[model samples]
Target chain A: MPLIKEGVLAEDNWQSLADEDNLVDGPIVVSLERWQEERESLLARNTPLGLRLRSDQSPALVVDDLERFSVVALEFPKFADGRAYSYARLLRDRYGFKGEVRAVGHVFRDQFLLMQRCGFDAFEVADPAAVEAWEQAVSEISVTYQPGADARRPALALRRSRPAVA
Target chain B: MYRYDEFDHTLVSERVHQFRDQVERRLAGELTEDQFKPLRLMNGLYLQLHAYMLRVAVPYGTLSSTQMRKLAFVARRYDKGYGHFTTRQNIQFNWPKLEETPDILAELAEVEMHAIQTSGNCIRNTTSDQFAGAAADEIEDPRVYCEIIRQWSTLHPEFTFLPRKFKIAVTGADHDRAAVRVHDIGLQMCRNEAGEVGFEVIVGGGLGRTPVIGQTIREFLPKQHLLSYLEAILRVYNQLGRRDNLYKARIKILVRSEGIESFSRMVEEEWSHIKDSALQLPLDEIARIENYFAAPRYEHLDDNVREFEVKRFEDREFASWVRTNVTAHKQPGYAVATISLKPVGKPPGDASAWQMDAVADLAESYSFSEIRVTHEQNLVLAHVKKADLYALWLGLRDLELATPNAGLLSDMIACPGLDYCNLANARSIPVAQRISERFSDLERQHDIGALKIKISGCINACGHHHVGHIGLLGVDKKGEEFYQITLGGSADENTAIGKIVGPAFSYDDVVGAVEDIVDTYLEYRTDGEEFNDTYRRVGLAPFKEKLYAAH
Candidate 1:
């Protein structure tokens, strides 16, 4: 599996740990349940920590520990479940989480642009061959109509073309 | 009536190119059907029973003669030379290759139209009163806000993939022509004691499976706070709305379960944070959108036109149409003329390419080149003058658009059932055609007076069966088509869900059952009471007795 960060394939150093499993040394990602249980113990160690959040989990859980984690992975249970997109926006816009926001599980080329617009800088997809497709998808629509976590200007920024009043 | 600006044009063209790539990838087996389904849905292309159905959004139901001509062109070029107008004020083409959709969308964008968000779970085409800018009782044109919402919701990053489809309807008048009460989010334009225009925000009203009327979260949201308030509602729903159960995922169920008070508090708290942010609509932007919908030039003719009066007296057919279809417009000389798509013994809301071209020509000549699509699946020439009524009537008559049955017995609302939609359990078009043939006489329909017979093939209620005066839900009973009848539903200011009658009737007996109900209404009604009013006045007893006795 390859991780696409900022529209390019990147080397991933973080390894995710299951909720019931013990946390290993080195850069590691953990689920919300494991983070809640092992927050102090993980903080005492010196490895970079990441949090894997399901769509159902709120970002407010890591409000104080946003600095402790270098990566925050939002889980898309399915492509159709869009709750994680809002979670990404909340992490970036509301909480001002400067760490790398990654999208994991059920992500693909079609959603790369939307996921990026919602401030997910890293996407962990199963297919390594989809990097080119993802690069094209992210830039397919240069113009946008809505403002999100990204800085793209809305179409309404153009002057209103109303008829001249006599 | 809005021509696309540079940014608008750019976005649509970009979408076309994007969809083309997606389709190419799909054909090459890079993307499976499961992956392509949502991608296709966002572009308003659907895999139906037979072929791909492309629904083009008619924004706020308003169209120019140019847009109308383009629709007719698409029908002739890509589809079966005809298109079906939907209850959401949209036009749908039934047959097109999945590969042809991008080209179809490109052509639509040439006319300032696109299929974006027409079928997705995202905020759908914002519907408004068909008579929005022309209606007499309107406080403000709802299309201004509708356009604002349209721009704000397009490709919205967060809310695009919700648990269920969301529909929003806005109405400027006191009478709910847009059926605001039954939508996912209903915006009613009203004035407060201070004489400032605002909205009465209603949340969580829907009809599929669990039908519930919306609860008012905001009593009066000022014009500027509209976007902020709506965003708050969406954010709350996105975080809290159930994704586990497809049936209970609508905002209505959320508002219903959490209690309106609790839901309102949550929305208010969310809104408090973002009220002053960039989402709050600026005054100039509001005025800019408002200016697009400003009143068109008008002629200063008197209200009474002797020529129109003479034609009505001389021609009974035209006069019958005037009685059922024509309504008073705000301007002195102009009148709103409803061209019924539901004629006797034809598929409702269907207009051929030639008929569409003829309508466009008529619009150019008579209605200042503007047309409207209504929630009742009818078209309206909203600014027709009194002097041009006869000429327009003759033009429509020649084109088979003069169906004198608007709001009458034969003017029924029906969904594309088993004939097209894959989700349907029974055929709705044949049933509607049979009923129309049963009451083919124009005079008989006029006598029945303003009865809405809404029929849906399945309980999705696309035909708005839950809101019809005589609602019919088509169900499959042991591999046979059986229709369950409901009585006294109205999707007006006084919105009420229809009650299910005694039992389900077979396909053959459904029409007779409706006839029995109408007969009962005719027998016991007061002098001027419509079917809905009469049914409300005298419960469902007489109709139930009459319908069940014959069975």
Candidate 2:
């Protein structure tokens, strides 16, 4: 899998460990269940930590533990399932998590712009040559209506600040 | 009608470019059908049984003459010279090649229109009363808030991929012409005891396989908190709505499974976090949107026109039309005229391109260049002079648009069923045509007054059969088509779901079943009782007995 960060292919330094796999010394990603089960051991050996949550899991469950992880990977499970989109916003706007939010599993280039607006910074893609497509997707739509996690000013705020043209 | 600003223009143009790119990618085999389905659906393009069907949103059911003419152009150039006005205050073109859809969208954008959110799992086009600004009974124009919502939900990043499609409706008048109670989020404008106007928010009402009437989650929500409050509700639904089963994914199912009290509590808890967020509407912004819907300048004239009364007395046909099609307006000399698309034996809501152009011209000449598409699948000239109605009727009669059956039995609502839709089990438009042909006599239709017969081809209930006075749902039993009848449903302020009367009827026998039901109603009705009132008073026993006892 190709990892895209900030619209470019980036190296993956973090290893996603399975349930029975031993945690290495470098930064590693663990499932929510594993994090909940071996919290003490993981905290004791923490070089860097990341948490992965399934689409069915709500971000509210790990709100108190958001400070312990440097990355939070929200799983899409499928492109049609949109629960993780809300979970990403909750992780950013509600819990004030200041870390990387990665999109994993069934993430496509077409949904990159929306995922970015909803506070996703890293995406796992099936092909590395999709970098140009991802760049074009993020910049295709320059205007949006509502406020999101992105820094772009919403149309409402722009209308409010500007004087009436007529 | 609200004109587009620079921001609105830019947003739509960008969206068109994005959709054009998506289409190119799909055609080039870069995107698969599964990946492209949501993209096309969000742009209001659906692959039906035949070619592509494109639904163009008429925001809040309002259109200018220029916009109507543009619609006529699209129908002529891209479709088969006709368009189907739908129950959602939108228009659908049945046959458009996949390659030409982007061009159609670009043309629509030239008229400040796009098909955004007309379909898909996101929020749909917001519907309001067709008689929004001109009705005498309206407390305020619901289009102001509808436009605000249109902008807010245009490309909402968080809610673009919901569990299922969402619908919202608003009505400012005491009477619910928009059928607010059956939508996913219904906003009824009302004044609290303190004399401040707000909304009575109704949540999770829908009409599909599992029909449910929405309950009031909030008795009074202040006007300024509309978007933030809606955001809270959507967030809750998006996070908690069922996603496992496609059949049970609507917000209505979630509300039903978690009880109204629990759902309301959860919504309130979610709302507490974002009540004062940037989603809150500033008063100036509200006023800015409201200015676009301000009342048009009117000439000071007498309320009663002697010439109109004289014309009415001289021509009985004109008198009947005025009684059924004309409604009172707040402006004294003005009136609202409904142009019935339902002729004697045609598809319920389909209009030809020439008819669209002629109606545009008529609207420009007499109706202050404004038109409205009703949720009941009809068109309205919302602002017309009372004295000019005779001339307007003459023009409409020539074009076969002057049926004078606005609320009568022949004016039915039917979906484009098995003929064009991929999901239908039986044909709906032909049944509507048969029913219309059976009740073609003008005097007889007037006698059987104010009945709404809605027919759906399948249980998805796009025709709103759940709320029709006499509802018909098409079913597939064995290898044949069958129709099931329901009685006494309504979509007005006192909304009620209809009940099934008896067994399903075959295509050949369905018209006879309908006639028997109507005959039973006529036999038992009082002097001035409508079909719905008669059915309510007598219940379904007499009608069922009349149909089944003879068999």
The alpha-carbon RMSD values of the candidates against the true structure, listed in the order shown, are 1.7, 1.0
lDDT of 1 by residue, B161-223 (tens): 888888899999998898898999999999999999999999999898788888788889999
Clash list (residue pairs), candidate 2: none
* lDDT of model 1, residue A70: 91
lDDT of 2 by residue, A72-162 (tens): 9999888888988899888888899999999999888888988999999999988666776987889888888888988989988988788
RMSD of 1: 1.7
Score candidate 2 by lDDT: 0.92
DockQ per model, Cα? 0.78, 0.84
What DockQ does model 1 achieve?
A: 0.78
List TM-score per model, in order.
0.98, 0.99
Candidate 1 residue-wise lDDT, A5-50, digit = tens: 8778999899898976666779999988888887888888888989
Error of 1 at B67 (Å): 1.2
